[model samples]
Target: MLEKLLPIQKNLNEQPQNPDSSPEESNTSPNLLESFKDDFFESYSFVNKATLILKLFILILPGVFFFMLALNDALDRKIMALEDDKNVLTDELFVYPDVQAIHTSVVLREQILKQVNEKEHYAPAMLDSIIKSLPEGVSIKNEMVQGKTASLILLSPGPLNVASFITNVLKDDFAQEVSILSANLVMTQNIYEIELVVRYR
Candidate 1:
């Protein structure tokens, strides 16, 4: 309620001032240094977990790597041993003198069969047909079978007998082809000698 009067005060302009900093910034200076120290020195929780994971990987990696290598080496040796045993067994089988020859013969037979594609086996029916077709005066002298073909030497009283036999043989279903290889007259025996080939279907 008194009348306004001028108050005595110090001259603040005479003192040096920091134009860049406020009172609020001056109060936070010490706290900034403390925060910097914490950031530099402290470990974060995520960083600790990552470091643990890295350590586990380092400890386990070499053991797993070496174990895999050893397992592979053992498998290789086992395979080699099996191969050696197989070779030895194969060789031992051939110790019987005829085994190798038999094997070779079988292999050759298979190759021949595959190439020839011959499917028929001469049965009793074939023998019956041949015997039935032969005339009474005609006789089969020598007979040999090779694959799908048969060769025979015959003694016939006359050429007519041979022709009749050939005609009868060709009438049978079991014969696919027929050929006469030779014909000769035997003066001493008074018989005609004939060679014949028959191919079966």
Candidate 2:
């Protein structure tokens, strides 16, 4: 046993005193750390590239979508405004006929009033002339005065009386032109009907 122990002791004395200190572990540690650093840098670079792309996508995509959405909203609002204007125009068009009618009636009324005012001054003299020239047997049935023209419907007992009435009207100084529109014998009333149109100077 003592002889076996002596060899073992000799082998033990040839070895290093510190069991934890190893040259191989010291040499391999730096290489492993370097490899780990290289791997970390590669991964970090890839991650940074991915992050940049993601950030760009995040920034631009939402902005593009928002712009498109805003444009659509603006177009929609414009269409609605146009529709509202069209409806208003349509409503006005619907009411236009009544407005036009009222305007036309007012114009016609004004024209009638203007004509009446213009002829008022000559009405008394024309009536006086007509009355004085009328024959004794001729009776006026209807008389219409318009502008410078007068229409008279006379009822006479005979053709001679009607002829005499027309002759008397033609001799009047106030008349510029006189025309016998119609002369008809009314068998029912046994009278001659004379229609005359006269124009004043």
Candidate 3:
């Protein structure tokens, strides 16, 4: 009986697994799934693209944040510099400590110029006053003011009229010193020419 069973097992072991089958053709489900996976997913798949985009975001966000911080720092520095410059300019233009400094020649020069301009601007009134004060047959030829001094050239019919004019100038509060620069007769015009310079009071 052992001999019969041994021969039967030997026969079973010697038989082929399948007569018309091969290893390559086995498990069609697993092979088809592997092939489908290879075709659907390539080198640049959705998973790879998502990872690349995430890496780029991680790199660029820090760079942008640092860049904005640096820009804000630069703007703050610029604003501080501007404030310093503004303070310096304000001190130079508006701050005055000493009375003498305010009355310095440069400052006085501007004031004097402004005063003289104002005086000249009211020249019509001055001329009107002069015309009203003039004696008969006495007329002013030229008149001008230089700082605190005023000059007048007048034509009169006689010396008495010139004397009258000098008395009128002295009576007024406009002059402190009256100087007779020239007093002469114009023979052709039959008139007396008088040039006077007066210091303002």
C-alpha TM-score for every candidate? 0.46, 0.40, 0.38
Record all residue pairs in model 3 with backbone atoms less than 3 Å apart, i.e. clashing.
none
**What C-alpha lDDT does candidate 2 achieve relative to the native structure?**
0.81
* lDDT, candidate 3, at 171: 72
Q: What local distance difference test score does each model get?
A: 0.81, 0.81, 0.76
lDDT per residue, candidate 1, 1-201, as tens digits? 232322211223322355676555444333566445445226688688888999999989998999999999999999999999999998987789797788999999999998767655675566777789998799999888766678889999999999999889889988887799999999999999999998887
Question: What local lDDT score does residue 181 receive in model 3, on the 0 to 100 scale?
Answer: 96
Q: Residues 13-104, candidate 3: write the lDDT tens digits.
A: 65456667664444334345654444434656877888899999999999999999999999999999999999999788765657567579
Please name the candidate that would achieve the greatest TM-score relative to the true structure: 1
Model 1, which residues run further than 4 Å from truth?
1-11, 16-119
User: Which structure is stronger by lDDT: 2 or 3?
Assistant: 2
Count residue pairs with overlapping backbones in model 2.
0
lDDT of 2 by residue, 96-174 (tens): 7688889999999999999978754666777777777887888999998776788999898987887776677678777
Q: Indicate whether candidate 1 or candidate 2 has the larger TM-score.
A: 1
Error of 2 at 41 (Å): 81
Better by TM-score, candidate 3 or 1:
1
